[model samples]
Target: MKLSDKAYEKFKHHLMMGDLKPGQFISQRELATMTGVPLAPVREALLRLELEGVVQIAPQRGIQIVEVSLRFIRDTYQLRMMIEKEAAAKFAGNASEAMISQLREVHRSVIARVDEVGPSDNLLKDAQGIDDSLHDTIVSSLGNELVDWLYAMNNQRIQLIRLAHGHLTLITPGTFRQVMTEHMAIIEALESHDPDAAASAIEKHLTAALHRALGL
Candidate 1:
């Protein structure tokens, strides 16, 4: 990847991993040092993040991480539901065996690791990865570039909300397990080739996620 892209990924990782708290202010130089990138690339990364509303730049102060507000959460979840419901319905109508297998494997992997679960950063990251993969698979199946782009942007905001929430209370291992179970419900509904069932499952999951985001 390009240096600027590397800087952006690293900076985003730190932000999502709770290394940088929401509403915290830090210098560009500090971000450069933290991400092991040069000042120019860090500046480029920060500019991108600023445009995304993940952070803001000030004249005299430094970059300020954006705070997650309830409105943002509600709006984001609404967008998520709009896309995911349609995607799930489509997926149920035409999901290939390979697609079902992929989702099933993701769920199985997370469930198998339940014994090793911990409230550590790595565990959270791993869970996030599996969750993202499952959702991305469904979203990508729709073959809509615009929808995919919007979903990706909203997903980042959701991650920020999750990180902010983690600061208040640790997400237990049971929650991750429950998440995987919820994912399995969607997968099962899709595998049944019942559009109504799949859409309903997607709606329920997104609704629960909105509730969780509200808790943030």
Candidate 2:
């Protein structure tokens, strides 16, 4: 990777890991040191971050990380719902039975494990992966690079928002199970090759998630 891209990735890693906080301000030199990259590369990274609304760079006041607000939560979830709902419809029309079956099985397995043994740290990790895979598969089904790029940018913001709200990673076992159940609903719609049902399921899941993020 180029130095600037490396810096950008490092910054994103720290942000998602909660090492870098939202609404915090740091100088370019400080960011460079934190990312272990040269100042020039860090500057380039900040420009990209600023354009993505991940950070704001002021002439004299240093860079400020995005602050999570109600509007931010709504906007992020709105974009996600818009993209994934369309993708889910497309995926339902084209996805193979075997792929849909595999998704259903994985979700069922996770829910069963949670029921039997309760949630472990490892199980939670597995649950997170299962949650991510379904959504990722749906979104990638669109096969549009520009849409993919936009989704990825918005996804970073979504992760930051989730981290701030303690929704996904810090979820309770019951809540995690509920999420898996929701995924099962989406998968079932896909399995049936019902595009409208799949899209509606995606919208319902995302709306619930948005509410959770908003603490409503």
Candidate 3:
């Protein structure tokens, strides 16, 4: 990998891990040293992170971690509801053995790491980039091309907005634990090959996530 990519990979992990707290200033020199990259490459990586809304840059003060916006919090949860509902309804009708296996695997992996602690464990967030992988896989398995294309494009914007908002992480390890039992409900629905039940589970899951984020 290129030095810039390497730096980004390293620093990105830190950003996701919350090791680099929001509103904290990050120096190019410090990042270069920490990630074992050169100054130029570290600078390049910082620019990329900045563009991704992961960090804010100042002329001489270097980069500062940014808090997520409330507007983004609303939009992201809204997007999740719109997209995941369609994904659930569509996938419910055509779910196959392979798809069920994959969904089960995601559940197991996430549950296993639920108590692992550290970076990998911090991924228990409700943010798009973090957990939407499972939801995206489910949606695509439905073989709906239009939903697939638009979801791919919009998911990034939603993820960016999600992480840009600080308090939004609460959407995950927050009270939403009660809400996440719906994933198990989804699994049961899929096991029975009941399209309506599966769609209901996913729809409720998305709806609850949205409402919780709204504090409603």
Best by lDDT: 2
RMSD of each: 3.4, 1.3, 6.1
The candidate with the higher TM-score, 1 or 3, is 1
Can you give the TM-score per candidate against the true fold? Answer: 0.80, 0.96, 0.63
Lowest summed-lDDT stretch of 10 residues in model 1? 166-175
lDDT of 1 by residue, 1-216 (tens): 999999999998887767998779999989999999999989998889888778989889999998777887788788899999999999899899887987788677666675555446676667777777777888888999999888888878877777777532233554666666678899999889998999899898778777765663
Cα lDDT tens digits for candidate 2, 109-203: 98889889989889988988888888889999889999999999998888778778775434566579668777888988998999999999989
| Candidate 3 lDDT by residue in tens digits, 46-119 | 78877766678888887887654567566666766677766666676677888787777776566556545522
Runs in model 2 with CA error above 4 Å?
Answer: 168-170
Query: Please, what is the whole-model Cα lDDT of each candidate in the order they appear?
Result: 0.81, 0.87, 0.67
Candidate 3: which pairs clash? 68-164, 68-165, 68-166, 69-165
Model 3 ranges off by over 4 Å: 101-133, 139-177, 188-200, 213-216
Q: How close is candidate 2 to the true structure, as a TM-score?
A: 0.96
Q: Rank the candidates by lDDT, best first.
A: 2, 1, 3
Candidate maximizing TM-score: 2
